[model samples]
Target: MLDLFGDEDTLALAESHRTLPGRFGAGTRDRAGVLSALSALSQQAGGAEFGIVLGSGFEGAPDLIAEIGARHRLLGAAPETVAALNDPFRLAALCARLAIPHPAITAGPVADRDAWLVKRIGGCGGSHIRASATGSTPPGHYLQARMPGRAFALNFLSDGRRIEPLALTEQWQAPSPLRPFRYAGALARGRDEAEPIPPAIEARIAEAALRLARETGLTGLASADCLVEGERWWLLEINPRPGATLDVLDRRPTPLLLQHIEASLGRMPAIEASPTDATGAEICYAARTCPAMPPLDWPDHVHDRPRVGSPVARDAPLCTVTASGPEAVTVKEELRSRTAQVRTLLEETENSHEFQHERPEPQRPGGTAGREPRR
Candidate 1:
């Protein structure tokens, strides 16, 4: 249960934790810091053995994966698999070979930049996706033509030989002035999901994912992002690791983590039908900067709590709000309401002069705020 942390709650679910030198973000700024952190964490492990199961943050950083794998066993996809899956050109070629519909992608200039999106080669989350018209494509980025359809993700477990579909989630974006395609949250498809995906369509998406996994030797928990309009669909990308929907889809009697471990060992677990309760999870971003976070009673539904006196930057994730109900619409509505309530709580905390005076001393810099608790 040894894991890494960066200004996030070290007291998070993991039994043991180590700290990274810098804050969390994309690119080279954090690379040396992560390797240094892993070095320290590995020594702390002593002679103990463990395996790595990656999450969203490491999708684009295969070098880090290889570095970690060199020291410890890997419980997920290999670094080469991750590198290939994260390449847009490689993905498009695979889709073409498999006859899966994929939007046209190119590194060269496009006639109508507005009609295309510039995406980083290994970007995770949607923050790296922007309209081509916004600016010239940066190094390590490519352009993909915009396609019509709603966003959906298919979650599955693979054993390098076969795959077992886990769950499908409908996704939405929380666009900001600069990040037009920022990922907001996801809602698991259930009996009450609005205009539920047809069985045939689900099967088609599942088959495509299976084919992609088999071809790439993908192992462990992974998710496939796609777009669907009516029966027509397009495979967007494969996040070769466990993704955000885990909050909504990980309630089965058998923990998906164990299943991931087993699958990585070439033993695929038999997955039962997904829970029928429509569960949703959304991020509550801070609207304004808070010089210091006030200690308050965080409701059970509100998770990823920051430490007292921690600085909360505007537009940074404050916490995650989750809700579940018999119907998807009502569950989503509840999520919105809860998100508002959490924001109001933060406002009230900021304005409380008495509480301000009584605010507890800040603890260590690391506390789980925006990043996932490493495992």
Candidate 2:
């Protein structure tokens, strides 16, 4: 995955690992650095089938991919589609034209700031969202009226002509003083479970996905976020890229990326039988500044780990914890237990006298802390 977080350990998980600092896109100031990274990725991917772009840093994916001068195919939507969907105002307009129900959205700086939210165009994680009253009408920002409901997302594949369901995930966020509106994790719905959304509402989502794909030239793997209220639902945004929830939903015998490639080539594969168990993943963030993050003999559930003695600021993620069970309750409990244990360990590490005596090195710039490690 061409994203911010590094899965250096998971190079074996896939053929390519063209990751760069994408946390905030600040550390990557030099155009030369990005060019160098892509050049290296291409070199590593000799005779490779294609290149896939994921995550928020690629606001200019169309331009960047073109400039990178890739030799292989580029999977996912057209550059024009990506650019159009990245703009919330344009997206809302599209939703209106398609009769897709969306939150009351308008141009920047609404008069009733308290009732709306300020969100960044092309923003991925919830981190870029802010209460309208607290935010200015900055460039690339728009307002959507705050809707009361739990957050949910649907992962689907499109073959330019048809849409296929992949999975439904419940999105979680832990807003705090340090990392307000932080993406905490997502829980995949089980086969024998009740979805947060009703069947009728889900049908609307499927219809919307197909229509959006038809209008926007969206193909390959993508996700659509929504706010579900009882029987009614409002569309939040559509991400026409490989999603972070793929880890939980992708259970086909064939690798999901291959299917993504097939979809891009205008083919929709039949959904194969897979795991019926509920799977959930969470991002465990540091509650306080930890000067020393010693590597622990983490259990098998842990992934996307930080290096030992890594100085993590308060609210930055330490690692990801995943659990599987027959139901969401058990999976959620397991995640909570593991997350609490890790947080305790982090607190202990911070209090150690070795940590106090040790002079920690400055953190690397342009990293997502611990969020969105897709590889």
Candidate 3:
């Protein structure tokens, strides 16, 4: 049952809509319409089993009867390897061949002027990124070497030799002096209630992500992005798909999408540990209007309640409000007073749908008023 980024409301809240058209790049004539919709959902679920690809979301498609370790197949580390570890320059050459402490790269393409970061050696979420300067090239490229600090993301889940550290956020708006990519909020929490990942920089980013998943033998879900500095972290890329907080591991307690379908059937299950102290938060706010129609109207002192019509654009994602308490300023003041009541009901329903279509009320882009101070 091919489900390349399946989205029938996340397979009706996760039932099992499996598919892996390289992970979501339904092009090339939608790859025979996703192999005829995975041969009619595999005769209503009887055959067809393993497959998981994510990196440039399945560019060409076809080639996945069983292959799951993305970043385009982690440069073929084989474990039933499918194909397509496409870009990010092989995750910065597997973190400099596992010396891990990345960020100081040069790969291919870039002429040098002063500041560099072209990105798209097969990008993700923060799509087609750019941040040039060092001899600015900007014309279909790949010139990284712009890593300074303050940008954190580490969502993990591996089985090729134990590795499950999930939740450690702060990937707010990338592409500014090199946040590289990821341009929306994600505050997740609990890493000792966060702000303290320095056990030798989290054991050098978990030993360079288990040495790039034991030299690319990558197993289920993976994510990494670091740059810390001052207790040092560095290593910037490596995302074998299933992250954008993968629904914050679906409020964990064992539900990382059903542990990526029970680790794609091999079943290594058992992953709870994410509360050395327990505290949670997730904030994603963006506006420029166009928040997809809805049966709107929500404001009951917002708390753990948001999923009204979803589908917002202007670079994807526009509403995520999570909040958990027990401390950490009571879950950041209940996710800052319920994301300010969902930003005043998305600015009064986009100013009453631009005054009933007569249009002309847009003029509010000056430093987003107040109340964004819960860092």
Candidate 4:
């Protein structure tokens, strides 16, 4: 298999991995580089047939997908379907038509900046979201009134004709000063086990997802993020591609990626949610800048390892940690413990390296260089 190898985690997953022409970030900035990389890889494929299955970053940019699909097959939603699902106004209208609760959104103006959030179009992760009061909205962004509720996502697989519910994930935030709603991690109960949400709410969300998929002809794995308060809920947005929960949900005997390809081809697999351990995954961020990554043993639960000597900036993602067990509460506790362990390990390693590299004072002309300064 071939992949863009955007991070170290993906670097080892594919037989042949290539980097894009430039750094990849949220929004529409990296489309050209993606096209260039795909062209190069396609040429080297020696006329072999291959299809594209995307993750989080590309769902907001259907034209880019169209450009990529022009040369190769796309094993996901069509460009029109993507445009329909991703457009904020269109989605709001669709929700209204379908009698689904949706937050008020507008691209034109915000009467109360404090009441709304500025979100970049096609932006995944909480980094791209900020209060409208923070700054003016840039191009390819919109304003949505902040909803009051806890965050949740329903992950599902679709085949254009039908859908299968995968898992219900409860998401949380890791707030920084600037990024108060930054995505921290998500937790889900064991497959086939009782989800954290009420059965009524789960049914409602599943129904909404199925209806939205039919309306947009959505195919492959996707996630629908929402906010729920008591029995009331609002659909936030649809990530029309594989989402972050893939780590926790893709544990079946048949790999989900292969199933994704089949679903995209209009064939739905008979995927029964088997009973499995509850899983939790979180993204750990660096607390300080590391000029060079120091060598240290990463725990078994830690993943997305950066190469030694790679510079890690303060507040940047350091790595991901995952945990799984028979119960959700214990799994979450384990995730927290593992996250702390990884952070502490990095801090100690860096400190030890600094001490090892410390330079001692040399003897001065007066032979008092090693002495402490006298008050």
Roughly what TM-score does model 1 have, to 2 decimal places?
0.91
How does model 1 fare in lDDT? 0.77
Clashing pairs in 2: 23-367, 23-368
**Candidate 1: regions farther than 4 A off:** 1-12, 23-25, 191-195, 357-375
Error of 2 at 140 (Å): 1.9
lDDT of 2 by residue, 1-375 (tens): 444444324544655655555454221223456778766777776756356544445653456645543534567676777767766777888999999999877665566678988776666567677888753567766788899988888889898889988888898887877346778888986789887688898889989988999988888888889989898888888888776676677666788878888888788877776568999888887777655556456677777666554456677766788889999889989999999988887666556665543556333344335343231
In candidate 4, stretches whose alpha carbon ends up further than 4 angstroms from where it belongs are 1-6, 21-24, 134-136, 191-193, 353-375
Candidate 1 residue lDDT tens string, 1-375 = 333332234366655565553334353336666667666666777856466666666766778888878877888899998988887888899999999999999885877777899998777678778889853578988889899999998889999889888778889888889778888899885754554667788889999999989899999998889999988889999988777787887878899899989998899988876687889999887887766778767788887677677666677677788999888888899999999999999888777775663456653343433342111
lDDT of each: 0.77, 0.72, 0.51, 0.75
Off by over 4 Å in 3: 1-94, 97-115, 118-130, 134-154, 157-162, 165-207, 211-223, 226-247, 254-296, 299-318, 321-375
Candidate 4 lDDT, tens digit per residue, 19-55? 5432223455377667776777777777785787766
**Residue 195 of model 3, lDDT score:** 56
Q: Estimate each model's TM-score.
A: 0.91, 0.87, 0.28, 0.89
The Cα error of candidate 4 at residue 334, in Å, is 0.9
**What is the number of backbone collisions in each predicted candidate, taken in the order shown?**
6, 2, 16, 0
TM-score winner among the candidates? 1
Could you tell which candidate, 1 or 4, scores higher by TM-score?
A: 1
